[model samples]
Target: MTETVKLKNITIVLNQPRYPENIGAAVRAMRNMGIDRLIVVDPRDYDLEKIRKMATHGCLDTVAAIQRQTDLKAALESFHYVIGTTARLGGQRRTGKPDATAEKIVSISQENQVAVVFGREDRGLSNEELRLCHELVHIPTAEFSSLNLAQAVMIMCYELFNACVPSKPAFTPRMAQRRELDAMLDQLRDILIRISYINPENPDYWMHHLRQFFTRIQARAREVSIIRGLIRQVDWYAEKRYRDGRRDERNRIMGKGAAECD
Candidate 1:
């Protein structure tokens, strides 16, 4: 018997969804693809009845088990890996094809909780929300390019499901959760700003590059802790140098005043 691909660790997250019907249909698609976990963040209207109607009786369990949160960041705190879906591409909105992205997801899912986040039906994930995702997956479409919310979810889920089979599992270490990585980045940003390494006015612009570097390396939890420790040491050294300089300046001024009195 072929070992069934287990997707219990993968979750579907809808960020600021506007319609109950779309949520329902997304849940139906998830169930069909054997993905049971669903999280909805700040939905405009969460009409469970309407969602259930679209999901039909078959996916009632998926709808019933939906997790609701007001904040997208908080909803993603515990996840080890996050993949955001995008329709528009340019600037920092780099995207990977669904099939290739699914292979990476499968590798990471072996040892971590992966969340595939989809944005609102009208507009996709905001730039701020996309920063939280380690990777972005885009479904290729015709020039028209606008895809229904449920349709996007189904295509992504299908690619993930298909990629699971015939792919041997590789050992991927448990990566740092979003919360841990965010904390480390916060400290890093503050230190970089204090040292004039990054512009204080818009620290996130430079920090985005750092975020990409860390994501590419797939930093582990212990590595995050080490980076935070290094930040603390840099903070201490910078403070010490400033204090020493201030003391030396004061002493020189006092000596000059004494010579003038003489």
Candidate 2:
């Protein structure tokens, strides 16, 4: 059958937003949609007088509790997947990958924490920042497709708010949290290093790819535990084999044998 992940599961992340008015309006858009979390990355200092004035009534708490991060990547760490808004289409789109619509975003949220990222008013999301996103969405518009920052936020928020209804799917498993997923990734990375599958000095080579791999799948909490258990077993075997191999070589070199035989 179908499941439902409500609008509460959604988050709005603004990257380097320059305008206090736009930020205030974004708060209203999110509040209107029943989405509460607001994460702003490297925001410029704006006068509270202007911001609160634009925020209107009942939105001050959101402005106060709003999270601030140094950059987009840091802001995105806790999310299972990022839906970055971008108008530019080059580096990432070189493979001809198209942007996702809001419906697809909702569908993916069935078992993942979805962060909808809007870039700065001047440049939109940088190409480097866009790479961190699991997918991108470009709101369709007439000629002069560039939309105002608040307008972009409003449209994306509207879609997610509405999509939480009958269209939402039914998911039985409790989804894995950010820290739990990171734990599994760390465990697997350690095992891979023990087995010579990955380099210890540069762990992120495969770790980054692994993160990308996991983001696509709607892996549940139980699934993450299962994978960690499996990795532990593999680690045990790899270490046991490697020790035996070392002992065998030493025995061959000397006229002696291993103290503990395999």
Candidate 3:
């Protein structure tokens, strides 16, 4: 049964990718690693015909199955666990040590659908986008933040392929999905707003800082989900109170007692 396990359940999500050759090379990487699915979100919309030549033979099927999404968050929701690639480090980004990252990937990759995401060559995944992922993978390099898109794709897929074939460990768990994490972030933002810790108009300013804080913890999906559930319960009670208070005010104005209204 372990031998039957495939890396095919993997989805490589490229966000706003600008180059066609990179897309072609990513397809080739997927082919090499036995990953057939590709999801490109709002890419530069390069000519697939031109890119096909770069994929060589027997790998165009990956390009054929490629699905374009309007955004990264939407593309990632179908995946149970998402790992975002970054070059930045020291704050929430998994840095230095391929062995540790490989173990992390295999542990999560073994259970359910997983998507490894990369951002545009220029800016990389935004802080908000990174928050949607379960963990971050920062490829180690020398004194530079830059990496070629296709090269990064190849390295990551290669690492993951190595993790898959060895069957390293017992499967651990299915993590919180992208949507669940997004919901938690939204609630956390709302709570911060309520506490006056963050201004609604400039919420992202604080959120980005907060995101850096959370990433360092390398939270498991269950842990984050538990926090989200607690936040929702609090939000629900607060909202119920606000609405009831409004009803009471209306009752008093209409000469119907609040108790009678209730």
Candidate 4:
């Protein structure tokens, strides 16, 4: 049986785009690739005539997408995975060969809304900026590795479109939502602290250890939720016992005072 996939919620996020024409071309490219959603963050000009003219039919609804964002980090937090397009190398290359990345995306294609991010024309995504992505994708290129903004989008979209559909169904892995992952992380920390395996006061040391451990496991969404539930139960009992002990100590002090007065 052939597994079906549709591009219902794929988003193209342009971060700090400098050229109006580039934005227009990107929109056009997305329209060609069957991508519907476009998110422009902190672009130079929202009302550029050059971009509007180039965008044509696709520009109608998407022209208003040009938005000013104070926090790009928060904006990306909800996405299941982020794919950054870059012609430049070194700091921005987050690994995975072109075919490998395409395979990875195929596996996690419909898990959540995927964001294909493009950085400014002059300089690509910063190291800190690229860190938000779950995996890094590089368009296979010659030594020169320079592609126009719209061309980059076209390449990524083509690969994505191709990757989403396969003759033999790929084994898709379920992933934890960002919120669920966050909760699991909190629970993990609390459980360790409660057990005195991790000192709450000097959390940095234990936090590093915990991060390394969890990184190895690569917990899925359902697995994370189940583990969190177990931790919550442990915390509930620990808290109840602690309160009861405090109450007992108070009663004992009061009873001794009453006897001494008598």
Lowest summed-lDDT stretch of 10 residues in model 3? 1-10
Encode model 1's per-residue lDDT on 220-257: one tens digit a residue. 99999999999999999999999999999999999999
Top-lDDT candidate index: 1
Clashing pairs for model 1 are none
Per-model TM-score, in order, reads 0.94, 0.73, 0.76, 0.68
Q: What is the C-alpha RMSD of each candidate to the true structure, in Å?
A: 1.8, 5.1, 5.3, 4.8
lDDT of 4 by residue, 1-262 (tens): 4443446546788888788888888888877777767777888776668878878865657666654565566666666666776655574254655555655566566565667788888897876676555556667777786788788887777666666456586654556654565567777787888789887898655675455455334457778779888888988898999999999999999999999999
lDDT (CA) per prediction: 0.90, 0.74, 0.75, 0.70
Error of 2 at 12 (Å): 1.1
Tens digit per residue, CA lDDT, model 2, 1-262: 3433457678899888898888888998888978888988888866666677787879999888888889676667677767778877654342211233555655556656778898889888776676566667777677777688988888888777655335335443445665567678889888888778888999976677677677457567789899989998888888888899999888786644443352
Candidate 3 local accuracy as lDDT?
0.75
Rank ordering of all candidates by lDDT, starting from the highest: 1, 3, 2, 4
Could you give me the TM-score of model 1 versus the true structure? 0.94
Model 2 lDDT at residue 54: 80
- Candidate number achieving the greatest TM-score relative to the actual structure: 1
Model 1 misplaced regions, further than 4 Å = 1-5, 165-168
lDDT of 4: 0.70
Selected candidate, larger TM-score, 1 vs 2: 1
The positional error of residue 24 in candidate 1, measured at the CA in angstroms, is 0.8
Error of 3 at 153 (Å): 0.9
